[model samples]
Target chain A: MLKNYFKIAIAVLKRRKFFTFISLFGISFTLTILMVLTAFIDKVAGDNYPDKKRDRLLYVNRIEQKGKDNMNSGTLSYYFLSHYTAMMKTPVKVAISSGFSGTNTYVNNKKIAVSYKYTNAEYWDVMDYDFTEGKPFNKQQVDNADRVVIISEDMKKQYFGDAGPVVGKYFEADNVSYRVIGVVKNVPVTSYMFFSDIYMPYTTSKADYKSKSYGGGYMGVLMAANKDDVPKMQAEYENLMKRVPVESKDFQHLYSHANTFFSSYVDTGNEGTSGVFIVVTAISIFVFIFMLLPTLNLVNINITRIMERSSEIGVRKAFGASSKTLVYQFIVENLILTLLGGIIGTILSVIVLAVINNADLIANLQLSINFTVLFIALLVCLVFGFLSGVYPAWRMSKLNVVTALKAQ
Target chain B: MIRLQNIEKVYRTDTIETLALNSVSLDVAKGEFLSIMGPSGCGKSTLLNIMGLLDVPSKGSIKIADKATENLNDKQLAQFRNKTLGFIFQSYHLINDLQVLDNVELPLLYRDTTAKERKMLATEALEKVGLANRVKHFPTQLSGGQRQRVAIARAIVGRPDIILADEPTGNLDSAMGNEIMDILINLNRNEGTTIVMVTHDENMAHKTHRLVRLFDGSQVQ
Candidate 1:
């Protein structure tokens, strides 16, 4: 029976070319933009590359030091991290890395700016970076301030012109000399916490790490043995935050929490709610509002289109079709139309993403419609179909049989 | 078999209440071929619609095939219609987007019949209407008489006990009209299917088992 309705729906679409084109244009155009947006968000926040164990990881990126008259909030300081994170018992590993900083280098007499970060030996174990040549600096090397660096494949190509075996060669940056110890794949800039052109040991920097300040230019990555230990780890960290005493006379209170990477990214200072729930609700509302106008337009168009088949509806009703059956048929027809539009939208998204990637609009960012994006697009299509179809179908089903027949 | 008692249908608005069907009582015997005749605006089609359960009477009780219909919900009424009644209309009312075979198989779609069985029954119906070769053709591709035949095929494909037709041949010429009347008469005599038809033609009425006349929203004869 559904097969028969599908046949009729295809025939109807073929019969009305103009309406089909208009509906397809609206649906495909709207869904194309949404698909591209989903792809980008998935690439940025999804479990990709070295952050695949995101479910079992937590981040402590912000520290708050408040006084009677002044309040300061910034990334965690190395001293604050080593003091507090060492007291937490839930985490199997805690890796601390300095915030990325920009430095200039001269390659082929042309000045190029490079972003770099200083990390400890355990940072390599925390993040599973795929190294292409050589190995990371050991704990002994970091303790000795070995002046060894690991550059991304992209930076290696830029400084060496695709030269072979430069792992032991000396590289100059910020007017300082360092021996390159390893080369790894380029991490997309979308991974805000992990993306850098080069990485070095924190001991090699001249900054003071023994300061008692509660805030500085550093972040900590916490890894739990399993996902179930994350909450316990968060609780332990929270309790430890209350125990840390303020050394400065100006500040009397200290505050921080161990949160997920996404939570830290969308940190709005709102307490008592996880950032995941807040961000998901915010995005859902945003998508709903964005789709409202197009859905209404499609509903209006569908009403007009289905109204033209009043006589056919009357015939079906007179032949023993219940109102439920008629509504189901109409909704099915609309779904077919929307799914076809989704196919076109998916193709358009692929082409658009390809253009963006090839155009080099954003460096190190390659957006593709992966499985998650495709599933989201499918869900969007179904929702669009239901939102645009239900009311019109209901209206048609309520039509008086006699009145509908007279419409012929 | 069908029965109606004090059937009343009123078309109301804020300004006026027009009586489309008055308090007219009717009874149709089993295996009876009944034709209803009246001038335009005489409530002939309204009476037929009420009997077909497509429209509710303003004040009346109806029993078709010995089952009381007033208390039946929408779903039960639809099931009763699907299992016990068939309908044909003046304009043929064929869906233009579907082929003749699909249109013929529509009533069976509401039932639990399989696709193969529906196709077989629809093919048999088309053969009965002498349009077996045109099953793949659309309604627009057929002539007016041919379209009426397709509508008849759709009506009888369900093999319902009663067939309600409102001016089934009203739009056809005399030759085509006689041909359609012959089909109805044959269905009545051979299959014993009770038929209640509303027609405007006297020549077609004379061939039925009985004729009913209406005037001014009431039965006059």
Candidate 2:
């Protein structure tokens, strides 16, 4: 029976070429845009290299120091990170890294710009960076303020002309000469926490690293022992935050919490508003509003399309079909069209992503329709199909048999 | 095989009420071939539709094959129609999207029949209608008489106990009309299947076992 329905659906589509073209165009165009958008979002926020342990990791990037009238908002200081987060018993490991800063250097007559970060040895253990040559600096190097650095693949190609081994090479950035001890794969700019052209030991930095002040440019990373220990770690961090004494007279209250990467990215430093909730609700609303117009258009087109077959509907009713059966048939027909559009959309997304990747539209960003994106695209197709198909099918099913038969 | 009592069908807008069928009662016994003849504005087609369970009368009860059809729900009515009744319309009402064999197999799709059984039954029905060689042809590819034959093949594909035809031969030339009439006559005589047909031609009416005439929604004879 379904085979017969498919055959009839194909014939109907073939008969009404213009209607089929219009419907397919709308469905495929909308799906292509949706899929490409999802792919970009997934690439930006989804778990990738270095942040692979995101599920079992928490990030503490921002601290709010509030007095009665003065409010200070910035990243946590090295003192606060080393003193409090290092003492937390719930986490398996705690790593600290100063926020990235841009630096300029000249190589052979051309000027080069690079973003660099100073991280301790434990930062390497917390992140899962794939090293192409040599290894990360040890704790002793960080403690001794060793002038050693790890550069990304793209940086190595730019500074060293893609020739010789980058390990044991020397380069200067921000007027500080450093010996390269490792070369790692390039990380996309979207992975902000782990994305930098040059990585150096925190001790080599000229800034104040031992200050007891509560505010500075530093981020602490906490790794849980297992996935199930994430919430326990967060609770432990919260308890620790409550016990922190005011280090400076400038602030009467200190607010800081450990959060997942996404939550930290969207954090507004407000206790009442959950970043996850806000982001989720905002995305849901965006998708809903984005799909509404096309769905309405498809519904209108489907009503006219089904009406053209009113006589067929009447004949089926007169023969033996129940209203439920006719409705099911029409929905199936609509699903076929939408799924075909989904296939076309998927192909179009692949092409678009390739063009963006090849064109270097975004620095170090490579987007692809991975499994998650494909699954979401398929779900969108089904939801779009069902939402667009149900009403018209219902209206067609409610058609009076005699009146439908009389319709032209 | 069929019964209707005081059937009344009214078409009403906000201000006017026009009756399509009024105070009409009918009975068709088992294996009886009956024809209903009337002018264009009469209720011949409306009565046929009522008996076929395609439309409900405003104030009436219907019984088909001894089952109280008026009380049956939509699903039950459809199943009952699937098992016991067949219909052939004047315009052929053949789905242009389906081939001849697939069109004939439509009624069986609602039943619990297997695909193989449906194909065999549809092929057999088409063979009986003398269109066995045109199974792959679409309705538009067939002539008017041939399309009617395919419609007849569809009507009998389920081997229904009663077949209701509304102007089955109205769109065909006399020769093609006679060919369709012969098929119906053969079906009635050989299988003892009851038939209720609506027509405007006296010659076609005389071909049936009995004739009932209607004028302006009322029975004149």
Candidate 3:
């Protein structure tokens, strides 16, 4: 029986080619844009590559260390991380690293700019940087403030023109010379925390390097032994936070949180709700509104189709079909249409993502559809089918049999 | 086996209330071939729609096969229409999208009949209507008389107890009309299928077992 309905639906669609084309165009275009957007968001917010241990990692990107009268709110200083964060017991490793800062200098006598970060030895131990040449600088080199650095493969090629093992070479950065100790894989720019063109030890750059202030241009990345240790470590850190000696006279209050990637991004400490929640809610509402016009247009097309098939519906109803039967048939027809359009949209979105990746629209941008994205696309198709199919089916079902039969 | 008592149908607008049927009572006997005759706007189609359960009367008591129909819900009414009654319209109302065989098989679709069984029954009905060779032909490919035959095949395919035809031959020539009349008469005389048909042709009405006349929403004879 359902096969019969499908057959009739196909025939009807074939009979009305222009209308079917318009409907398919609307559905496919709407879904394509949505899918591409979802893929982009997924790549940025989701865990990808060397940060795979993100689940067990807590980040302290911001800190507010308050004294009696003056509150210092900023990224944690190297002194604060060394004194306070290194003492965290639950973390398997507490890594201190400066945020990537863009630096320009003469490399091979050509003016070049690179994003670089300074870190201690544990930054390498906690991070999984795949080395292509030599190896990471050890504790001795970092402790002794040796002029050594780890450069990305792209940076290595840029400086040495693909020279083999450029580990023993010197590169000029911000007028300071550092010998390349290792070459690592290029990190995608999407990984904001880990993406850097070059890395050096913190001691190499002297800027009040031993200051004990609790605020600066550094962040502490904590790797716990287990995911469950996150909250426990945070609690212990908070408890120890209260006992910290405050010498400042103006700012008195100090507060900070150890947050996961999402929690850190959505820090409720800054807003009434998590920024991630707010962002997700806002995007969902925007997408829904974005889908409204197309969905309504499809619904209007469905209504027209129903009107055109009134005589057929009349004949079916006269033969003892209930309103439920008519509604079911029409909705199934709508589902078939949307499913077809969804397949087309998904294909188009994949092609679009490939184009974006190939064009390097964003540096090292790697966007691909995974199982979750596929599931979302399927969900969109179902919702679209139901939204566009229901009202028209119901309206057609309520039509007067006599009037419908009389309709041409 | 049908009974109607004090059936009245009122069609209303914002400022107008037109009576389409005025307290009409009717009874159709088993194996009876009944024909109804009336001029246009005499409520013939309204009366037939009520009998077919396609529309409800403003005031009426209807009984079909000893079951009261006044309180029958939409589901029950549809079931009754599917299992007990079949309809043939003046325009034939054969779905243009379907083949003749599919058209005949429609009434059986709502039933619990399997696909293979439905095909077999539809084949038999189409053969009876002399459309055996044209089972797969669409309605647009058929002549007016052939479309009417397909409609009749659909009507009788369910083996319904009652067949209500509204001007079954109104669109056909005299010869095609007579041929349809012969099929209805033969079904009534041989199979005891109760048939109530509305027609304007005096010749067709006079050939039925009984003739009913209506004028201005009222029974005149």
How many clashing residue pairs appear in each of the predictions shown? 0, 0, 11
Q: Let me know the DockQ for model 2.
A: 0.70
Instruction: Please write out the lDDT profile of model 2 over residues A61-136, one tens digit for every residue.
Output: 8888788877888788888898998778988888889878898888998888998998989999989899999899
Q: How much lDDT does each candidate structure score?
A: 0.88, 0.89, 0.86
- Candidate ordering by lDDT (highest first): 2, 1, 3
Candidate with best TM-score: 3
Residues A23-96 of candidate 1 have per-residue lDDT tens digits of 88878887778877787887788746776678888988887777899777778788888777887788988888
Candidates, DockQ: 0.64, 0.70, 0.64
Error of 3 at B28 (Å): 2.9
Tens-place lDDT per residue, model 3, A228-314, is 888888887777778776646665666777777876755544523566788878898988887887799989999999998898888
Interface CA root-mean-square deviation for model 3? 0.8
Which regions of candidate 1 fall more than 4 Å away from where they truly are?
A17-39, A48-58, A79-94, A206-215, A222-250, A268-278, A290-305, A334-361, A366-395, B1-5, B27-34, B60-68, B173-195, B202-211
Question: In terms of TM-score, how similar is model 2 to the real structure?
Answer: 0.88
